[model samples]
Target: MSKILIVGAHGQTARIVIDRIISETDDSLVLFLRNSSRLNEYDNNSRVELIDGDVLNTDSLVSAMKNVDIVYSNVGGTDLAKQTASILEAMTKSNKKRLIFISSLGAYHEVPGKFGEWNEQAIAAYLPGFRESAKLIENSNTEYTMIRPAWMSNKDEIDYETTQKGEPFKGTEVSRKSIADFVMELLSDPTQHIDESIGLNKPNTDGDKPEWI
Candidate 1:
């Protein structure tokens, strides 16, 4: 069984991934979060190892990464690059190679139409850092898959499609569950799409702007 380490385990997307992992597989999970108190529900899960660690602290990250085979990061914030850089450094030091990262659609300026324009303007400061993090992963020697997902919703659906780096990002919004499903697939089969940066969106969502916006 694969020993998967999920950074930013308290995140909404990561929570869904954790639930799926618990239900669907016998793989072990290292759930890393800044606050261990946030994971009260997982206290009884034997397969889930809850650890408190800051992504910005290399020593903390290195400690959290011990015996981990794959690292799936669901981190997001204005300081995205710094966090990712730390994770990469720790991964390198620990000799852990496989990585799956979650990024934003606007990070690559891939969002299209009016929605894309709005997204760029909305998260102007944050997008650049995400882009930088993507670059950091792309330039690394680690086997990685960087996922850039469009505007996310809490909608209950798992229907989504993907576009590679150069392609125009399709649709306007994708559900968090859809993103979780995709991530789970990648974690289940790490060899697939080893070095690709993919843009994800719900199929048939073409519009001038996202429906929710």
Candidate 2:
């Protein structure tokens, strides 16, 4: 079984991915989080291991990288660029090649018009970390797949479509569960999305253009 490491494993999207992995596969998991107390919820599983550490600490990250085959980074913070740089540096030293990074949709400045205005507003509110972190990953040597999902909701549906580095998906929202499902799928098969960055969103089923257009 591939040994996978999940950074920020307690986050909403990470929780969904972890649950899916637990139910569907026998793969071993190492969950890295800032606090060990929060891990009580996932402690019963024998296949899961918990590590308490900050992603910005290269020593901690390097120690965690040992024997880890794949890494899914979900860390979020004000210093996103620096944190990602630390992780990338450690991964390079350890020679761990596969990475799945979660970024925000407007990181490429593709949102246009009024929707673009709204996107910029929202991005201004919450995208500095994702943008800088994604920049770090884009410049790294590790084989990586960066997924930027549109405004996330908590709906537990998997109905969604993907766009690759082109026009951003024209949706107002994408379910976090769907993003989790996509991450799980990527983990199961890394070859399909290697070195690619993509956008994801729910498809237009009501014959109306999504708000993000």
Candidate 3:
């Protein structure tokens, strides 16, 4: 059974993935988050280990990376590039590879039309950090796939499609469930989508902006 290390395990998508892995696979999980108490629900689970740690702490990351076959990072923060850099360094020190990082749409300015303009204004502050993160991951030698998801919703459905780095992004929004489903698919075969950045959105969700806003 593969030992998977999930950084930022408290994240919504990570929580979904954790439940899925526990129910569907024999994989063991190391759930790392700053506050492990949030995941006390998994305390009795033999297949799971909850760790109270910060991704910025390379020493903590190195300790957690021990014996891990893959790393799935569902991280959200203001300094994405900095966090990504630390993760890569920790992986190298730990002699591990394979990373799945959650990014956002427009990292490469791939979105098109008025929607693109609107999106830029929506998350203008954090866009550059994501773009820099893409560069860091791509330039590194480790096997990594950056997941750039469009506006997310709490809807309990899994209907989504993907676009490559250079392709104009499709649709307007995708459910967190859809993103979680895609992440689980990647975990099933970590060999796929290596060193690539993918964009996700729900089918038929094309719009100048998300319907909610």
Candidate 4:
């Protein structure tokens, strides 16, 4: 069983992915989060281990990378660039290669049309951080798959499609379950989409903006 490490284990989609990982695969998991106690229910799960640590701390990140075959970063914040640097530095120090990074739409200005403009205005504050994180990951030596999910929703379904880095992003929102399902697929085949940035959204979700907004 491959050992996978999940940074930012408290994220909503990450939680779905975690539950699926336990139920569907035999892989062992190391869950790292700032507040590990938030998931205290997993304490006795044999295939899971929890660590409370900061993603910005390279030393702590390197320690967590030990014996970890794959790393999934579900973190996002205003300091995402710094966090990405720390993750990359620790990966280099630990001699680990495979990583799955969760970025956001518009990080590369790949979102198109009126919807794109709307999204830009909606998340302008966080765009710089996402862009910087994308830059660092794209320039890194690690085998990385960066996922840029569209505006998120809590819908209870998994129906999504992808666009490559240079392709125009489709749709305005996607269910978090869809993103988790895609991440689960990547976990099953680490070699798929290596060093690629993918845009994910529910098929047929195209619009100027999400329906709710």
What's the best-to-worst order under lDDT? Answer: 4, 3, 1, 2
Candidate 1 off by > 4 Å: none
| Clashes per model (N, Cα, C within 3 A) | 0, 0, 0, 0
Clashing pairs in 4: none
Badly placed stretches (over 4 Å) of model 3 are none
Q: Candidate 3: minimum summed lDDT over ten consecutive residues — where?
A: 74-83
Which pairs of residues have clashing backbones in candidate 3?
Answer: none
Compute the lDDT of residue 141 as modeled in candidate 1: 81
Give the local distance difference test score of model 2: 0.82
Candidate 3: C-alpha lDDT: 0.93
Model 2 regions more than 4 Å off:
205-213
Instruction: Please give, for residues 1-213, the per-residue lDDT of candidate 3 as tens digits.
Output: 789999999999899999999999999999999889999999999999999998899889999999999999888777888888889999999998899999999999999999999999999989988989889989887899899999999999999999998899999999999999999999999889998899999999889999999
Residue by residue across 134-211, what tens digits does model 4's lDDT show? 999989999999999998999988899999998999988899999999999999999999999999999898999998
Ranked candidates (TM-score, high to low): 4, 3, 1, 2
Error of 3 at 196 (Å): 1.3
Candidate 4 TM-score to native: 0.98
Model number with the top lDDT: 4
